[model samples]
Target: MDSVKLGLKENWKQFALLVIVNGFVGGMVGMERSIFPQFAEVEFGVASKTAILAFITAFGISKAVANYYTGKLANKFGRRTLLLFGWLLAIPVPFMLIYAPSWTFVIIANILLGLSQGLTWSSTVVMKIDLVGEKDRGFAMGLNEFAGYFAVGIVAFITGYVANSYGITPYPFYIGVFLSIVGFLLTLFWVKDTRDFVKKEGKNNKTVELKNVFLETTFKNKTLSSVTQAGLINNLNDGMIWGLLPMVLFSLNFDNENIGIITAIYPAVWGIGQLFTGKMSDHYSKKGMLFWGMLMQGIAILFIPYSSEFAVLAGLSAILGLGTALVYPTFLATIAQATSPQQRAESIGTFRLWRDLGYAFGAIISGVTADIFGVEYAILTIASLTIMSSLIIKFRMPVNIKTVRK
Candidate 1:
C-alpha cells in the first residue's frame, strides 16, 4: 500500500494530465447523446429515427476499425505519440458539426470522433495499467474512469444547457473542438511514454507484428476472453444508454436540462462509485465484483422503463452507474492480470475492439427497436440482454475469490 502511494505521488502530475485528457475525450464523445437526434432532424432534414441510426452506425464501424489499429500504432509509434495524434485528429470534429452542410457531413464528423475515441480513450486505459502496475491497478483504473465519466456527465449537462439557451444544436460540438485541441496539446507536452515499463519486464525484444497480434496472445488468454465477453455486454448497455436515453427522455417531454441530468447520472455515478469499487476489487474477487456489478446493472435497466418521474429516473440512472462502476475497472484489472506486460497493449486493444463493437451492435439493435417498438420497450429489451449477460459470466468465468497478499 505504501509503495502504491509512493508511485502515485511520484507520478501525480502525469496522472492528472491523463485524467484531464481522458475526461475531455469522454465528454466529447458523450456530448452528442442528448442533442444529435435533434441535430439530424433540424439541420439535415432527416427523420429523427433514421439520423440516430446513421450516427450510431458510423461511430460503431469507425471505432471498431480504429481499435484494431491503435494498439499496433501505439506499439510502433509509442503510446504518447499515438495519444497525441488521436487528440490532434479530434480537433476538427466540432468545427465540422457546427458548419455541416448536410447529414453526410455529420456522419463524417462521427467517423472522425470514433477514430479519436478508439485511439485516445483506449490508449489511456492501457497507459494507466502500464503506469500503476498490477497491485494498485484497480484504484488507478477507477480514478481514470471517474475522471472520464464525471466529465461526461458534467459536459452533457452543460452542453444541453448550451443547446437549449442558444438554440444552436452544434454548440456542444464546438466545445468538443476546444477540449480536444487542449487535450492534444497536453498529451504532446506532458504525457510520458510507457514503453519503458514493458522493457523492464524483459520482453521488449519481441517483435510487434500488427497483423497477427490480435489473433495470437490476446484471444487466447482465458481471463482476458472472459472479460472481453463481459466487456461486450457492459458496453452494449452503455451504447444503448448513450444512444437511446436522450430519445427516451425527449419522448417523455422532459426538458433538455432534465435529459442532461438523467444522462449525466449514469456515467457520474458509474465514475464516482468506482473510487470504492475499484479498491474493493483489488482486495477481493475480480470475477465476483464483475458478476455483482452486472447483476446490479441488469436490475437497474429493468427500472428505467418504470421510472417516469424525473427523480425516479435519476435514481435509476445512479443505480445503473453503480453497476457500471463495479464492472469496468474489474474487467480492466482482469485484462492486466491475465496478460504479460509485453502483450498488454495488444490485449487491451483487442479487448476494446470487441467492447466498442458492442457499441455498434447495441446502437443498431436499440435504435431499430426504439424506432419500431418505442424507446421504453427498447430499454426493457436491453435489460433482458443484460440479465442474460450476467448469468453467462457468473457461470462461465473464473471467480477469483482470493486476493493478492500484501
Candidate 2:
C-alpha cells in the first residue's frame, strides 16, 4: 500500500497501458460505426429506419445499465476484475457479428458489446483517475480519451475500407475479433487494480457528499446535474450522428470509401483535438467550455443537413468533433470535482448511465422523426435540442462552482 504513489508520473507505465487498452475498447465500437446501419438496410431487407436503429437502442440501454453497475461494484469486486471480465465477455462479439444469421443476432452482439464497453471503458476511466490523483487529472483524462476516440477513428476508417473493398458483413467484423483478443490479453496480463490509490486519495479528499449520488448526479445537485444533462444531450446528438449521419451521406450518393472518410472525420478530429482540449480543461472554466462546446456541436449539426458538397460536409463534421472534444474531458473533470472521492465511481457511473442512454434516446428520436418527417428535419430537431442543452449549462451551472475539495 505504501508503494502505491499517486500521480501520472508515478504510474506512467500502467497509465500508458490503460490508454492502449482503452484504444482497443474504442476500436471495438468503431467496427460498426461507419457501416452498421447501412449493413442493416443492405443485408437484412430492413427498411424502416427505426428497425435499422434497434441495434443502437439495444447497445445504449445495455451499456447504460452496465455502466451504473460497474461503478457500484468497482470497489467491491475490484476494478481489474471488471476490466478483465469485460474483455473476456467481448471476445465473442465479433464472431457473432461475422456469422449473424439475422438482425436478432446483430442486436444480441451489440448488447454484449455494450456491456463489455461499460465495464472495460468505465474501468479504465476510473483507474486512470485513481492513478493520476489531482494535479494533472484533466490532462490524464485527455490522453485516455484521445486514445479511445483516436482508435475509434482509425478502426472506423479501416473497417469502412474493408467494407468498401469486400462486403460489409464478415470481413469488417474480423477487426473486432482481433481487437477483442489483444485487449483481453493485455488486461489479463498487465492491467493492475487502482482501488488502493482511490483509498489513498479518498483519505485526504473533502468534496461534499451528495445525499444521494444517483439522484444528485441525475438531477438534484445544481452544477453536477447541469453537467450531467449536458453529457446526456451530448451523447444524444452523438447518437443521432452515429445512427443517421452515414445514411445521410449515402443519400448524397457518396461512395462507401467516401462515406467512411466523411464519417471518420468527426471522431478523428474529436480524438486528436482532445490531446490539447483535455489539458485546456485544467486551466479554463468548466462552465464556459461546456456551454460553448455544446453550442458548436448544435450549430455544426444544423449545417450538416444543409451541405451536400463533400468538403463542406467534412468541414462541418470536423467542427462537430471539435465541439465534442471541448466538452468530453471537461465533463468528466467537472463530475470528479463535484463529488466526494469515496463516491466518485458511483457518481460517474450514474452520469454515464444517463449519458450513454442518449444513444437509445437519440436512435429512437432521430429514427422516428426521420420516418415521419425527413432526414433534414430530424437533424434540425436534434440540433435544436443540443442548443437547448448548452443553454442549460449556461444558465444552470454556477460561474464559480463550489468544487474545491476541503
- lDDT for each of the candidates? 0.78, 0.91
Candidate 2 Cα RMSD after full superposition onto the native fold (Å): 0.9
lDDT of 2 by residue, 1-406 (tens): 7887999998999999999999999999899999997899888888888888889999999999999999999989999999999998899999988888999998999999999999999999999999999888888888989999989989989999999999987899999989999999999899989999988988888876778989999888888899989988998998899989999999989988899998899999999999999999989888998999999999999988889999999999999999999999888888888887789999999999999999999999999999999889999999999999999999988997666544
lDDT of 1 by residue, 1-406 (tens): 2233224556678777787889888888767866777677767777656457678778877887787677667778888877887887899888888888988988998999899888888788877777766568888888888888788888888888888888656566778877887888888878887766656542333333333446643455445666787788888888888877777788799978778788888888888898888788788888788888888998998888777899898998999999999998888777766656666677778888888888877888788888888787888888888888788778877666322221
lDDT of 2: 0.91
The lDDT leader among the candidates is: 2
TM-score, predicted candidate 2 vs. hidden true structure: 0.99
Backbone clash count for every predicted candidate, in the order shown = 0, 0
Lowest-sum lDDT 10-residue window in model 1: 202-211
- Can you list the residue pairs that collide in candidate 1? none
Off by over 4 Å in 2: 404-406
Alpha carbon deviation, residue 49, candidate 2 (Å):
0.6
What is the lDDT, from 0 to 100, of the residue 120 in candidate 2? 94
User: Against the true structure, what is every candidate's RMSD?
Assistant: 3.9, 0.9
Could you tell me how far off, in angstroms, the CA of residue 260 lies in candidate 1 after the best superposition? 0.8
